[model samples]
Target: MHAVLKLSKYLKPYKHFAVLAPILMILEVAMDLVQPTIMQKIIDDGIVMNNTLYIVGMFIVMIACAIIGWLGGAGCNFFSSKAAVNFAADIRADLYETITYFSNSNKDKFTLGKLITNLTNDVEMLQRALNMLLKVFVRGPFMFIGAVLVVFFTARDLFPILFFVVPVLIICLYVFIKLSITLFRKVQEAIDGVNTRVQENLSGIRVIKAFNRMRHQVKQFTGVNEELTKRNMTADQVIAALMPITQFVVNIGIVLALMLGVVKVEAGANEIGVIVAFINYLMMIMNGLMSSSNVLIQIARAIPSAERVVVVLEEQPDITNAENPVKKEILGDVNFEHVSFSYNKQVEPVLKDISFEAKAGSTVGIIGMTGSGKSTLIKLLARLMDVDEGTIYIDGFPIQQYDIETLRNAMAFAPQKATLFSTTIEENLKYGKSDATKEEIKEALVASNAIEFVEKLDKKEQHELTQGATNLSGGQKQRLAMSRALIRKPKILVLDDTTSAVDSITEKMIQKNMKELKGSTKFIVSSKISSIQHANLILVLEDGRIVAKGTHEELLKTSEHYREIVATQVEKGGILHE
Candidate 1:
């Protein structure tokens, strides 16, 4: 609850709307209170007193109050809803900015699925609470207190029954709130779990189908679905007893008020018109109490959700640009000085004591056994993660010394896995370099050996790439991704086994183009020796440590592990395709 109030600071500029909305709603409540008093006047002072003119006058007054109430209620609804939606837009914008700053560690900590849920569903829950509270928060309590005041002025003798009745109502609602908030938090966690499962299934649907694990996947998803259902039921269970309990309290109060009213009216302390008004005020108080109960229920649901959004918004990234970071020329020269890093604090390092350099206009091929930290090395060069132990530099400037956006422009690091957005083919390529021209796009596609197939597409560069490029074949996707890297023409190009799916002929063509496109440095990591055979330097890594560093031929003599990898994975693929 404290967390929610703190977040409301963003709503301060919109507070005028917030204030105006409730005041309008109070006018409606005020009309409700005044109407019954006018009816009492019509009955006692007009109809029963045989004054025809007074009856007409009182009836006209009641109609005017109804018009004011209608207009006030409409105005209240208009402003409150407007404030809620605009506030949600502001919150969503802030949340997206926060997401952009999240470290890779934090990104992996909360998977993409859970983040989507937080951004969409959790935000919606908080928005609903805001709308309800702004619209009804004031009127509910004001109506309750105002009813009591009207009752005191109209018939003070029977009103003491309310003191006992209202306290009991408040206690019941307070306990319900305490119990429901706990269950709502659990429900949100269950939703997160379900989101994770669905996201995994969708992203890896190809793998699941290839492995023939559809039933196994279905069983896993059902387990999460069942748990989510159970959690929703648990939240519903807490409120199941609430309405009956509230009704019982209201009924008891009504019977007591009637019994006491008869004694007072018989003693001439009150008239029947006054008793009638008393009954109406008592019901008005109960209506107000019920509305208050609903408001509390929304608050309970919103607390857990609002807190989740704030967690992401308030998070500070593990890596951020330092103040006054050094600006460096776009030099392709690269160096690593005894760098060591681990994704996990307690585990063995992913890359240990790794050091190497590839001067401008040179090629460095990285080869090793699986889990040899080849890909991890380039990831650090891109500032995807920090080197926990040592340092990395580009043209004598530490990787951390440049802002993230500025540094990335000088280098292109395409991962082993192929990822493409659901957009036009030209749009996806443009992400690599925003202002690429048609001739440049053709040159890059030709360099990556992708031009042949792309020219066959219905719309060529204008073709739409479906979700994850599912409509395209694997080799085609690789070609498109490679073309993106080529088009960037960065100071350094790092390809992490990106040609693994392409044919030997295509791989050879890509390597040939890299040589022709001189000046841009290339760092190729592959188990296949042919991919990096033309390198000026070769670094053989094994178990996070560098085993050998030299030309391709030099590594065959100095490194036994490099020799074995060449004998097994490379010997079968002389054409550079595997």
Candidate 2:
């Protein structure tokens, strides 16, 4: 409930609409309350006296009141809709912006499916609740209190009927609302489960097909879908029962009112017109209670949703720019002094006390077995994940001293997995350097050995790639990804096994073209010895430690591990010794 209240700040921009909606709804309620008194007058004064003119005059007044009430209700609906819709839109936009700033570690805390649900489903629930609150919340209490006061003053004997009816309805509302809230929370969790299952299946549809497990995936989806359906039915059943119970209580009250009215009329203590007006006010009171019940049901659903949205809204990104950050150009003189990191503290460190240096404009190659932290090492250098221990320096200053964007902008990182958007090839290249000219794009394509195939395409750079670049071959995707990085002509370039999909000859050609960026520092992480043999410095890693570091010829002479790696690759005809 507190979480829901916190979101009210989003309504500040729409305060005019928010304010007008309830005010108009109150006016409508006032108009509705006036009708019972007018009816009492038409019956007691006009009908009892047999005055047709008086009855006609009061009838015309009733018609005017109805028109004003209708206008008020319509205005309330219009204003409430505007305020709720804009409030939701602003919240949705802020949620997206917050997600974009989430660090890798922060992203790990939330699944893709759960985040989607928070942004769409949860926010929508709050929107609906706010809309109902503006209209029903204002109308219900005003109508209830107004009816009660009118009945008490004009028909004091009949007012005691409300004492019995109101308490019974209040008890039922409290019980139903409590039961529904717990069930609604479960329903929301079940929805999250369904979304997660669907997201996983869609993202991995290819893998499922390749493994011939389509039936298995279908079974899993069905289980979650059934769970969601069951939870929804359970929550709705509780709320559905509320309407019948409320109607039963009101019906009993109506019967009692009729019996008491007959007794009073026979005793000549009450006029028939007064009895008729009392019944009308009683119905109005019941209508007000029903409106309250409807709003409570919405609140039960919205409470859970508001909490979920607040979690995202209140989540502070683990990575943020320093208050007084240095936003300066980076020269890419890199140093890792006793750096160590682990994804989980309970697990063994992936990189342990790793100390190394790469001078500006140097090419350093890293070769290691699978899971030897080659990729993890470079991720630290880019500050995707901060080190658990020690500091990483760039240009003789700690990396944290620089603004995150400025530091990241100084380097271009082409990861092992090629990620490309569903856009034209030229637009994808422009992501690296938004203002890049056609000639610069062509140069990057040529350097990455992607020019030959891209030139052969009918539309060349204008050709549209499918999502994840699925339309292109693996090697082609890798080439385009490398080209995207190379287009930046960054001060530091880190290529993590970027050419593994290309042939050895093509890889060699790409490596040759890389020399054109002579002033940039480069770190190439690869499994192939041939890829790094010409590097100014080569690092051989094992068991999360740099066991050997030297030029290829120097390492081959002095390090047994380096010699064995070269020997194995040479025998397999995977390396071309220069």
Candidate 3:
């Protein structure tokens, strides 16, 4: 309930519709309540007295009431729909924004599958609940209470049947509500499990196919699907039993009411029309209770969804702009002073007491074996994750003192795995700088050595790439990603194995182009010795420490690890240093 209440802020903009919907629903219910009384009048005052004029007058009035009821119901539905859709839209927008701004650790904590489920499936549940609130939730109680009030005024004796029936039905509903809450939570978990499996499978489809694991994948998916189906069926069975149980209790009340009515009529305690109207009121009350039960079932399901959404909404990002942010432009120089970091506090640090400096406009190369913290170091420099100890500075100021946007805008980074959206080549490049002109985009492509193949295509930069850039070659994707980073004209450029997929000739050409880009500091991380040997300063990393920091000529003579790496690559004839 608290979680659901938190979402009420979303209703502020649509409060007018939210308020109007219930008002219209009350009018509709009032119209419905009057119809039975009018029928009673026609039967007793008109038909019994053979007064045709009175009967026509009552029927016309009843028709007008029915028309008004129709209009009121329509108006209620219109307002309810508008409020519900806007509420959902606002939540989805906020959720997307929250995700986009999440720090690396925060994102890691939530995980991709859970976030997707919360945004899509959970938000949908809340939307349905919103619609139900203004529709049946309000109308149901109004009908139930109004019927009871009218029956009490017209036939006080019918109260006995309600007293006997309502308590038993309430007890049954309470039990169903309790049981449904637990079952619905399991249903939502099953949905998350299914979504996780599907997301994993889709992302690794190529690996599954390459290893001929299609049958294994199918078996794994079937397990989750069956679990989801079983849980849903169990929940549905529990909810399905509710209607029959409720009906049995209401039917007994109906029988009792009829017996009492018959006796009253015979004893001249109540008129036949009054008895008929009382029975009609009893049915209306039963309909209202049943509608309320359905809404409760929906609420039970929505509770878990609401909790999930609240969890996302309430999360505060660990990284944010400083209180007094500085927006000065970066000068390409970077310094790390006694920096250390760990993904988790309980675990050993990934990077340990890492300290280095790269002058503006210099090429700094980072080479390490797998798990040596090459990527982690880059992440710290970009402020994607903060250091466990010490500080990283851009130019002369600590990176934390700068506004986050300005700090990030100063550096352009390309990761080991190149990612491209499902869009045109020009649009992908512009992601680095949205306002980049045609000439700047062409220059970026030329610098990255991507213009060769791009010019061969009829569409050139307009060529559309598929999801994950699967439509393009691995080398082609790398070039496009590099072009995207270069187009920003950043003060500092970080490339993490960006050219590993391309041919050696193309890689050297890219290296040549990097040297030509004046005043831009470059940090290149690669496994290939050839890629980093030309740097003004090369840092050979092992177990998160700088094992050697020197130019290629100095490292070859003084560092055994650097010598071994060069010897290994040269023995394979894969690379050679000039």
Candidate with maximal TM-score: 3
In model 3, the Cα lDDT at residue 518 comes to: 82
In model 1, the Cα lDDT at residue 165 comes to 84
Alpha-carbon deviation at 236 in model 2, angstroms:
0.8
What number of clashing residue pairs does each candidate have, in the order they appear? 0, 0, 0
What tens-digit string does per-residue lDDT give for candidate 3 at 104-161? 8888888788899889988998888888889888888899999999988888977878
Cα lDDT of model 2 by residue, 11-43, tens digit: 999999999999999889999999999999999
Q: Report the error of model 1 at residue 535, Å.
A: 1.4
**Greater-TM-score candidate between 1 and 2:** 1
Q: What is the C-alpha lDDT of each candidate?
A: 0.86, 0.91, 0.90
- Residues 207-228 of candidate 1 have per-residue lDDT tens digits of 9999999999999999999999
Global lDDT of model 3: 0.90
Off by over 4 Å in 2: 45-51, 571-573
Q: Please, what is the TM-score per model?
A: 0.96, 0.94, 0.98
Q: Model 3: residues >4 Å from true position, as ranges? A: none
The Cα error of candidate 2 at residue 81, in Å, is 1.7
Question: How many residue pairs of model 3 clash at the backbone?
Answer: 0
Candidate number with the higher TM-score (2 or 3): 3
